[model samples]
Target: MQKLTINLALITPLIFVVMYIIPLGLRDLWSPDEIRYAEIAREMVSSGNWTVPTFNGLRYFEKPVMGHWMNAVSQLLFGENNFSVRAASVFSSAGSALCLWLLVERFITRQMAWISTSIFISLFMVAAIGTYSVLDSMFSLWLTAAFSAFFFAFTADNSAGRYKNYGLAGLFCGLAFLTKGFLALLLPVIVVFPFLLWQKQFTSILRWGWWVIAIALLVCLPWGVAIHLAEPDFWFYFFWVEHIQRFAATNAQHSEPFWYYFAYLPLAILPWLFVAPTAIRHLGKHLNLPLIRYALLWAVIPILFFSLARGKIVTYILPSMVPLAILLAVGLSSAYQKQTRGFKWGSVVNAIVMALIASAFLILYYLGYLPLEQGEHYRPWLAFTAFSFWALFACLAIRTTTLEAKICCYSMMPVGLFLFFWASIPNLSINSKMPAAFIEELKPYVTEKTILLADHPSTMSALNWYLQRNDVYLLNSKGELEYGLSYPDAADRFITQQQLAEFIKTKQNNSTLLIFMRGSALPETQLPGISKRFQRGRFSAYYFAKDTSHD
Candidate 1:
């Protein structure tokens, strides 16, 4: 075990690089979420307006301002690159891991704490979201910190410590509120109150919970009041559209069946899921204990609550993974000490799955079924190499004598795979899902004076973020920008294809106009004087320089 500890201490830095840091810049910012967040942050930095969040210079009330501020600060520190864009999320994920480590250490053993931290970081969903330029990881971080603080306070040995930790929890709750809005307050209330009630310490809420509320409100007051004063309707739109309608309406955004997370969670947990059956069985023996009970309540309740909501996304359940990591770590540790076959079976399952994947890649490549350009011949071998390493490591894990060594090997399995994972993404998916690559090539020709246009707000956002310009016009459809586009001031830029023709006629002959359209976008019959055209995968870009043809 000590040897495993020393190895982990040495390997942790490598894991950080392989799993977390490397992914930040491996691919261009993915559409809507990544580019959307990055643009808002860029605008926040450029416009010097931190109070209101804007996307392409339109009022976007979908979320609160704290996340943009974090991203903005990251951009400031690191300049406008992929690392800066995703730095906030990466740091937030690390923060959550640290908070989990602290709780596991106090409630369980230091060894278990280390194991839990390792497991949490290695989990596929956690690592994936951590490096993505989105607000979910930041939101999950605050939720984890707040919940951990509450747990510490509830279990604290004395009064002063309890209040201090409670205050800390409230502070995080407020920051979480800032990150994603009332959700920060709602989720904790749903979990903590029930937990305190279950502890038969419900009266403690009457005595001390008021202080928590006061502290949270105080922390949120500056931003909350500022936003309300800045845009009086923000609270109304955000509360009704983003919260109420999104959660309860029949036509809520991203609505899915209750089993949505139930299905994706296994994928989220990945190799750990191979062992979860045994781990859960082992942990079941300790469910009645206070620490385990508290963690369980924290993990399970939010999933049920979110399931109750009409709308759902995989990331919505991310905070639930925190206590889950603790529970799984404890359970896995128990099973390891008991010398059960569950661990060996887990390694065997991981090996089998990886081997099958590697074999499938080879079969598909040999059969010529893979969608690859001639130049992408290397991606197949790269993927095979990655999956083969995964299978090899899993076999090593099973053959390894020590529990710590086995778990360490299991944890490192994804690192080799992730190294090649980005390189292995097929160009087909890249063309549709990731537009930044296509947009980056066109960025050199664009300038502040250039009129950029796209059929989709998602594509427009990519142009906006990549070109570092907010004036990218949405051609024909407002999409998510519907509410923002309805305002009279935005009428000039958000126009139809016919209007685009008339609009371009008024521009100077030297002026540049670029249109980016996806595979499904209607063919252009109205666009005139196309000088140059570029087609990449399913996307087509048409360039116009007014009565001049460079073709």
Candidate 2:
């Protein structure tokens, strides 16, 4: 036991360092989502208003305030960089992995617990999303912790202990709700209620279910009530437009086919992808067990629920990872015990797949299918990493005799992924849609006195973050920002093309006016004396000097 404790102490930090910590601040915040969330948190911290979330000085209410609040706190402590902004998610993800270890340890062997937790963290989607500055990882963490706590509470032999566990479950559920809203509560209900019915625990559920609901509401009510009191229509907008309309209407523009998530699930858990079918079969053989039954329901119900919803995205199915990891751990454990042929063949197949992908990239580069400049820059690193993974897996396939060794081999996959990501960092920065350098070039022209105008602000969300100021004028734009702009205080920030032209013509001689628009949207006739100053990617910036003559 002492040795086990020491091993865990050493392993925990090691996992964190490899999975979350070392990669911190290595990449720029990607556009559209990462930058938007980071900037909102920045605005929150700068404005000293925590109740209502704002993006680019507009009252943004697309998401709940918990993520923004956590991010603001991170920035306060870490001084506002990519690492600081993403720190909340990184810690939350690590916390979730720890919780998974503890939860599994309660019901299974400690070795199995460690294996399950490792598998959970190693999955491609889990590691990738956890490192990014997004709310989904935090939400998934809270939801998984809540479910795990509830499972413990529900399965407890003692009545008093069961109620206490219910309280913890409620608290975590409430935290989850704060992270992402009603879906948190909805998912738990969908997962747990069916398990209760299947177990015929009607009396037990009837006795404690209301307590769970009451505690969750108690924990969640303060923020909900506060937001409602501050904005009378907040509840309507949050529940109706953000939740109901988002799910029911495609007009929100996030439309994808119903099969999107189904197709994505296999890839999301890649490298372990070949083992999934065998895991499912193993799960079917053990369905009679209460824990296995719960795992099955936990995994399947969310996929079906999200598949039925009109709106879909890749991360919506993150909650399923918990149960999927549990099932995979069980399957792998059994494979080790029984020397299953499936495990052996699956490892071989994974190796072949890796080799094929790596060879294809090398072939493409040689044949000129890839850009010669970038390809030449990336080829050596890509070749080394890919071939290395292929060789490692191939060796394990050919030489490994024990299932224990095979499971150990799987751990290297995530390490290889991070190494590849680290190697590709330079290329990713160059190819990123966000104009980090371009914005840096515009810094001299942007000042407190400068009048900045964006032809369509919605398309260039990264500008809000890089510019670090929200006083820019928008000309002819409406989308996600529409909600924030609809409020009376933000009306003046929006201007028409004619209004922008007039402002340019009549601006004070001491003040400079800059216009940023898409390359295609640049007017055929330059605005009198406005001269194009910078052009990068799809965006172009024009400078209107105070003393320049009109055309």
lDDT over C-alpha atoms for residue 96 of model 2:
82
* lDDT tens readout by residue for model 1, 388-497: 98889889888887766776787788887777877888889889879877887887777777778888888888888888889888887788898888778877768786
Candidate 2 error regions (>4 Å):
1-13, 250-252, 372-376, 383-387, 422-432, 455-460, 508-510, 517-519, 524-526, 547-551
The alpha-carbon lDDT assigned to residue 106 of candidate 2 equals: 81
TM-score of model 1 relative to the true fold? 0.96
lDDT of each: 0.85, 0.75
Tens-place lDDT digits, model 2, residues 161-273: 88888988889899888888999889988988899999888577678888888889998899899888888887787888889987888674477777989899887786578
Superposed model 1: Cα runs more than 4 Å off:
1-7, 508-510, 521-523, 547-551
Where does candidate 2 clash, by residue pair?
Answer: none
Cα-based RMSD of the predictions, in order?
Answer: 2.3, 3.4
Residue-pair clashes, model 2: 0
